[model samples]
Target: MAMTVVTGSASGIGAATFSALAASGREVVGVDLRDAEILADLSTPEGRQAAVDTVLARSSGVLDGLVLCAGLGPQVSDAKRIVAVNYFGTVSLLDGLLPALRGGEAPAAVAVSSVSSTQITWADNPIAGLDESEVEAALEVGGDYRGQLAYAASKNALTVAVRQRAGDWGAAGVRLNTVAPGAVDTPLLQAGLDDPRYGEAIRSFVGPLGRRGRPEEIASLICYLLGPAAGFVHGAQFVIDGGVDAQFRPTAF
Candidate 1:
């Protein structure tokens, strides 16, 4: 039986991905902070462990795929919370799921990153070596800061980790990669879209695509990457940002 694990399955891309995977003939175990069958907080060690435990239990001690879709875009009062959920959360969960992945056939893990990370230059990362506590300490600088930088930084870290570990996992016949999504119309985007100024900017930013992306569109690509179709693809970041990244953000024309 093909068994897969999906995080952040309560709503948005995670929920849609879970539904897609389930429909693909894979027995999926979804992990969320809500009161779902596979409930767990990705930011907590205990919660991450619980999610892995549930997957193992359901899969009879193995897992075929792991979808690391649980993440946030700097909503907390502190930026550390963003790193905790987006960066460290992904690392912790992957570590816990490694054993189960090793036992499965052609195991693949897809992490959901963001197009926002493109702004972060890979060479000058300050938090690259910092521990979780250090990350928490940095967030102590409170002010009008929105933690948007932290959100992009965290995903940058995740992208690096995925690339770094791909070779190691490939030795074990497992593939690990990341998907960087553009502006999508998930409930999570409501917080930004509700703001008049921000909403107007975002609406115009998704140019050419003409609108925010549907969750199912992203889910379809994720599913394809996890399946045999992307057999040769590994350790790469797939950008699904609808050409927004190529836009002229600093122009007056």
Candidate 2:
């Protein structure tokens, strides 16, 4: 039996993914600040470790799949918090739980990146390989208002990191991949859509698919990627946008 751990399972995409996985008969462990078996803020190293400990404890030392869906977006005002939770928090959790996963049966990992990662370019200036101290230093440079750029950069780095992790975990029968979702109908999206300043027009433009994505839609993909069906797929980032990225043109071509 495959044991799965899903972060940010309190609500939104994470919650939906958790429900889907559980329905599929996988031993699912859902982690979140609210209903999480492990209660710790992802912003701090201690918190990240605590999350790992909880998962191990809950699942009894065997981890077959890990879904890194817990993340914060640009809507967050605090830039350092964003990096801490979305970036470092992810890396920390993965590092702590990887050893357990390596010993499991056909272990696999999936991270929730963002479609925004596709909009930015940060090739030479890689976000991975940096220590926690360095991340803190970068946070200082990023300041309190790193905005969308920082969010996109962080997610982009996450995508790249997943690809690289495949190489390291491959020999151990562990596969790693990422999912990048577009505008979805979640609390996060509703909040952003409610912001009169950033909502209306943007929603209209991105909703060419009729409307924003439902949580279940994204959940389906997460479940599929984590299942045995995705065996041959590794180190890839699947963008779940409604043809928005393809149609997006800054100017008439």
Candidate 3:
């Protein structure tokens, strides 16, 4: 059976993807802070390392699919935390698992970015290969008061980071890509909507489709990217945001 590892498998897109992959007959290992085959906090380096080590040992150091959906919303009250999980954690875990992916059958990985990634340009992201201390100082200097910019920066940086690694991964028979979703109606979205500071603004912004995305909808796209169907689809970013990105920057792309 094909072996896969999914992060944030506790809820939202992660949970949905986990279920979908299992239903597809993949031997899926879920990593989360709780209620998963591997429990560890992606927000912390130590937790991320533990999760990776466990997956490595369980899968016998060979992995076919990796989906990094663990993240924090902008309303988390801590800008650093957003950068920690959204960017640092994803990058760290990806690095730790790259060796296993190299040994799999037609391996592939998909990371969850955001339409918010489009809110900022690559030049403004400045977080592709930054350390925690550098991210903290940058966030402090950039005045990410509510961590909104940090959230955008982290997602944007993730997409770029994945793209940068595509060459090597593809050469090694492993594919890598990203999915950038807009406002999806998940637990994470609910948290943002409930935030006193960002709620009103989030409510005001709606996709052209006039409805938030469903977790299953995003999960479908993620699963496709991980399968043989996407064997040639490497280093790409699929935006499943209900046309939000096109509406915001139609001419940009």
lDDT of 1 at 154: 88
- Candidate 3, superposed: residue stretches over 4 Å from native: 126-128, 141-144
Which one is best on lDDT? 3
| lDDT of each residue in 78-131, candidate 1, tens digit only | 677788889988998888888889998888999999876666666755567688
- Tens-place lDDT digits, model 2, residues 27-101: 887777888655678888888888888777777788989998888867677665767777788878887888889
Q: Which stretches of candidate 1 lie over 4 Å from their true place?
A: 139-143, 195-201, 248-253
Q: What is the C-alpha lDDT of each candidate?
A: 0.81, 0.77, 0.89
Which of the predicted structures, 1 or 2, would earn the higher TM-score when compared with the native? Answer: 1
Candidate number of the best TM-score: 3
Candidate order by lDDT, decreasing, is 3, 1, 2
Q: Can you give the TM-score per candidate against the true fold?
A: 0.91, 0.89, 0.96
Clashes of 2: 0
- Judged by lDDT relative to the true structure, which candidate is superior, 2 or 3? 3
Clashing pairs in 3: none
